[model samples]
Target: MEADKVKEACAVVAMRCKQDVAQYIYYALRALQHRGQEASGIAVYSGGLKVKKGVGLVSDVMGPEDMDKLSGKVGIGHNYYSIKVSRPENIQPQSLKTGIGDIAIAHNGIIVNSQLIIAQLKKEGKLFLLESEEEAFIMRLTDTIRATDDIAKSIKTVCKELIGSYAFALLVNDRVFAIRDPYGIRPLCLGKLPDGKGFIAASESVALDVLGAEFIRDVMPGEAVEITEDGFKSINIGASINRAHCFFEWVYFARADSVIDGMSVYEARKRIGWRLAKEAPAIADVVMPIPDSGRAHAYGYALGSGIKMNEGLMKNRYIHRTFIMPTQDAREISVREKMNPVRAVVEGKRVVIVDDSIVRGTTMKKIVKMLRDAGATEVHVRIGSPPLISPCYLGIDMTNRDQFIADHRSIDDIRKEIGSDSLAYITIEGLVEALNFEKENLCLGCVTGEYPVNIPGERRRFQQTLEGFT
Candidate 1:
């Protein structure tokens, strides 16, 4: 039932600097604010680990007074998007006192085998304070540290037991540890600060860019990096036999400016748009994007199809993204407030609307209706990514099979459901080609119904299974 609790897809950033790391992390979190908006926090090591977390946006949770108190040269920050109601206890940099030292962790991605691990730990007489996967992770790591007596070895042992995606930033005493899952299903990168002041590891390169840090490279899959004021070192936790990087990162989750796994996200999206145009060209007068995330994709489509690109829908700057809302009702209601049609651009025009992807189709349906109401002669939809037929067990919120509009539905059927003149999604092969990665290297779980990681009751591309963990 991991799918039933789809409460993840967060951002994590860690910094080890000579100056106060908290303020830099604040700016980094602001850059990564798009990743998660429900909650934000930062844990710094002053005399010890000092944590400030709350259930609100980064700016709302941490003001000048809040940042003034966080005095440290090394720290970690998190931006969380919870599919469940926001609670203070669930906000992370989830910390614990281990046998090694004071440990605090901020993680991005979902743990599919967490329930099994939690059950096993319960039988061992370990008590949990909260119903959260971060608590479970802390408990498991605590046990592993107790047995191994080494931080690096402990992380390796925990990685073997974990059967899902994760990109973690851990503060153990004064040093920081950055770890990525074996499949690299989530994005994590390393960066060097100006004047060789410090090192950083974040969920995206954009986080580093905001702080004027130099992007070094992505953390290798199954690699654990230990960073201190002196420097940093990388340790191979496990060999990534079948590296399955999440494809959705480039499609929608990550900021368009980010370069994930060495591929420019903006370039990949634009290429996907070009490919989509080639695969499903529309005879529309003006091509318009859904705004924000869709701008790059729509631009590529316009380039490929030799059509002019226009902004038909203007996004409200204050509205939170509807896709990450906790409930369907909230998502549906937010869509109305999130966008408004430009009557001059869309009216009496044959419009081709380009978007990154469609999950439940409610947003797209509302958008199509909004365009028609604005006097659009016709609204055709062109998705930059392939149709989602399966739930994402790695990190995305589309966990239920029934939540996908393309699930067991044809293209024409989806067109009718969304009330669009036409609908087409990029092909899987086209998407892979556009990303410039081998099809085997990308995690197309939601698109192909086959995951790279071992999820219970799910089809895995590899032979790995979660039976042993259970």
Candidate 2:
């Protein structure tokens, strides 16, 4: 429940239209600001490709004057969040000039085989300009296939060599290319503008909504799409594998209004709450949410439990996501500054607090104490997702096993630690059922510890060393 519960990966948006699309991409990235806040960039192609990028929020990086400089009809945008220190080179829409053309790419997930690809490229006498794994991997792959005239063939070769999760958008001169990982570990969707003159691809449906585009459908797992003046053409460039869409998208990462892989995130979360109410019913006077992420789940819980939903907490709109803050103390302070209990609603009430998940339990304990200080007689906590017991290797920030409260503690121990009168979590089975998708299609890696992709032993050890757990 701490502010650093789970960090999100990057976001990608690409537009191919008759008119200039730099502004469209700018607005779409703003809609997806929740996905990443560390850095933002955009690449547009008119007569030639132009890109503007910096280390900050979208508004901070791109002012009116900045947007005026990037003029193009086809463009790609990226929003990045790094577990490591953010730097200017790490900022993406990473571009390279090759014999074929200038290539710009924006990526949204981790490439597990990046080291292997980098080494191979090195053996081939190639040099990498960017330090980020995505930039290195993409640039090397582009270099490998620079001789090919067909962009689709180049992308297919790249997809064949890479392993792990990713969804990327590429800008090649006047064309745009989009590809989702074989397992669809990340979300990507295609849409059309109101006049049907342009095509949009983004990390979430909500981005398309902001552009007044009609959602066409999700790009199938392992599929590659190329948008040009001719039309949108797609090919299955990846191997046929079981879909392992990141389940956390519905649980925590996505905007409530977004839909991923045919599942409505808001609807999925509401179902999670509905199922939680049935499975872990807590006796209380009122049902309340933690605000924001907990809102939809709390509404579903209230409906299922036949309890009135009340606004027991008010959030400060000015406060940014605490997880992005620099230090633990800063994040803790953010929690206090972000929300305050409504004494009139919680005073002398047996309140049932519905939340999405509890990671470290640091913020949850503080929240319970805050409610108690404001006169709540009882605080019953219900988490929509099952206990997180393992680290996520596919771009989520929960890579350190020691940071998980559930990793070493029992459910009862967590409840006592958080000072909740009672605590319950939805079962893994219940969560999968609520999603209403094939059970195998969901990656419950954090909950189940069974990763869909094979994690190389060396990489695992390296990650442990980085976390100081070795």
Candidate 3:
């Protein structure tokens, strides 16, 4: 019952500027805080790398006194959402001294083959200070740096050893390096601060918008960029033969106000709703959203169906996102406190409820019962994205096959489970069309169960393997 739709890995932000950038990084982290809330950390290089991290919200972890001490013109920050929150050392913007120089790294996606690399390192008598994927990343990078004696070459070598999605922002002394995986399964972008004083690279363009920075462009897939106060430089190692940009970003993970990879997240979501309206129009008296998550999609659904849309649920803004809550009990309690049904609007009305997607069916089940209790005559559910039938290995938190309601259930079964009068979801082709992406260029792995990269024991969309660099 702990299925809160979907959750992403974390957010990474790095900056190099003429003036102290610790404050700016803090603000940017606030803007991207929705991406993670488990832990917050910042690493800055002021003659030396200084790091302050703790398990909590950004506001709880980094106070004014803390920021005053993190004096540096170049720094990186991370907002982490970890399933294993007991390990405080696993929190990131993980900094360590390397043979080349002091380096701090922040990561935004999963490294599927990290265990293999870690095993190889341990076999070679290498020891680790932390037990996490980012730890494995830094160890491997330092090992390669010891051989190549070149930061750029070491980064390229490390990229080859990784077998899954990653968007890394590395702080090397006073420089910042931004790197994206070959498939670009996650989003990362470059931006410029006003007056040419600095440059920023972050997981989303919304970070740039908060800092009044100009978005340069998306960091290309398989590219590594070097940034300093003066400017930035980039080198493309090898773009993937097939692009697998995660379509879920538009559906759920990203802020609706943000734009990613040339597509507006809000627009894509609305378009998905439009598609859903045409494919699964409900014969209802009114259309209403499940609250903020479904608002944009509901707008498009209303527009397409020519049905009046009304706010039938009032969200409790103070409630933390139920999906990111640590435990099943916490998630269930959160669902109870997160939203309330508007009895006046739904009373005696057949309500068509729009939502992004349904994962566990527990949350939806509770919501449907609430609506019924509040006098909604009929509760029909329309989903913007296709049913999630597989777990995401790239960066999302749906790791177990049994957690998905659609993994083994049909539409009618799900409808019965959620106590909905009817249920329908957007088709995969409709999702691609709404996102305005060619099917081959998008990662529909969670829905289709065919990933772009070669994951052992799972189906791959292509024959490409993570080889050559090893």
Candidate 4:
């Protein structure tokens, strides 16, 4: 994994000259590296777009020397470890031909009923070299746009046929365009560089921040935005009211500094801890977060619960994120090397470990083991969100259902396996309440299974019942 970029998934793009296109692309990617780390690639559309893509980082896959090699006024880039297609062949910036012209695409999010769409495309006898769910989406959009001549209309029609979440961007015939899914399950923020030479299409605003781009508003749900030499235009195609931003972004994925819907992720998480304290009050002597993202949540939990927040765990900041590790052995080693218990705070006292979520139960088990080894009397585990039983086809790599312990196991069953004295997951209902159900902007697909948008990938894995659990 690349040392500096921590993201495991995402895409970034911008337009114009003055500043080096390839160079700026690299800078944008470094900020978005959190979205994907498996592979990084970039494409530039100067005279006739030149593209470079492979399995590596923005720095590793692209260098200052390489940046000089690519000369394009309009460019789009992606940092991906394709969650839907796992196969390297199935990933992005696909250069395809339509009756209109040649188009290059970069996409974030998933196509829900991909199989159905692919079957239809197959019946039409479209020769597809890349069968990834993403490729199919590009093919569909191109086919529609070619016949319509109106880009927005074509996108609107394509969106109607689409079934899942997505934030799609494309470098089409020297122009760039982006589209957010009807529900906006994934994030797509637009920003302008300090010079106003171009606009950025990014998964998170944090990337925009890094580039000194003014924070442009998030691409609204069901909106299609096009950027050309002339200017930019936005069009809406789907129901605005049903828009559901992925709640997981707040619980775990998003950077703390980002503001979504005008709310800071750190602030939202702190509120989550405060709510958790009220909903599941415990008499623990001290409140300790599991480290990393849980820190802010821990602060809120401590303040709300009136428990003394302690640095019970000593985090070895030098170690990289274990989740980005490609091998199990590497991950295990990273986790152990990165975390250790502070005996001064943990010995002979019951401790509460607040974490984002419990997936396969392996990480939690290992953490519990560490707590016990440190001489803790009892360890209670509290997850900031409910179990993640569904695979996140949109962007996250939580694909394999077999890897999800919550899908097949009960809460009690998971508690026993993790070896925690007690375990409590935040209620889904509580999640809605915390958000004040203020508007129709939150996506609870992972927790509720009722995607505001359709998800065809659900059947690609397991078929378990999590409805009654919440």
Ranking by lDDT: 3, 1, 2, 4
Clashing pairs for model 1 are none
Model 4 lDDT-worst window of ten: 461-470
Put down candidate 1 lDDT per residue, 327-411, tens digits, no spaces: 8767555766778899999989999999888877877888899899999999999998888889887877776888888889999
List lDDT for all candidates, in order. 0.85, 0.84, 0.87, 0.73
Q: What CA RMSD would candidate 1 show? A: 4.0
Model 2, position 433: C-alpha lDDT score: 94
**RMSD to the hidden true structure, all candidates:** 4.0, 5.0, 2.7, 5.2
Predicted structure 3, TM vs. truth: 0.95
> What TM-score, computed on C-alpha atoms, does each candidate reach?
0.92, 0.93, 0.95, 0.87
Report the C-alpha lDDT of model 2 over 320-402, residue by residue, as the tens digit: 64355798777657777988999999999999999999888888998999999999999999999999988888888888778
Candidate 3 lDDT at 104 equals 87
Poorly placed runs, candidate 1 (over 4 Å): 1-8, 321-337, 464-470
Q: Could you tally the backbone clashes for each prediction?
A: 0, 1, 0, 8
Q: After TM-score superposition, what is the CA distance of residue 97 in candidate 1 from its true location, in Å?
A: 2.4
lDDT of 4 by residue, 66-133 (tens): 78878777788888765443566655666766567667777776676788888999999987886766
Of 1 and 2, the candidate ahead on TM-score is 2
- Alpha carbon lDDT of residue 378, candidate 1? 92
lDDT of 1: 0.85
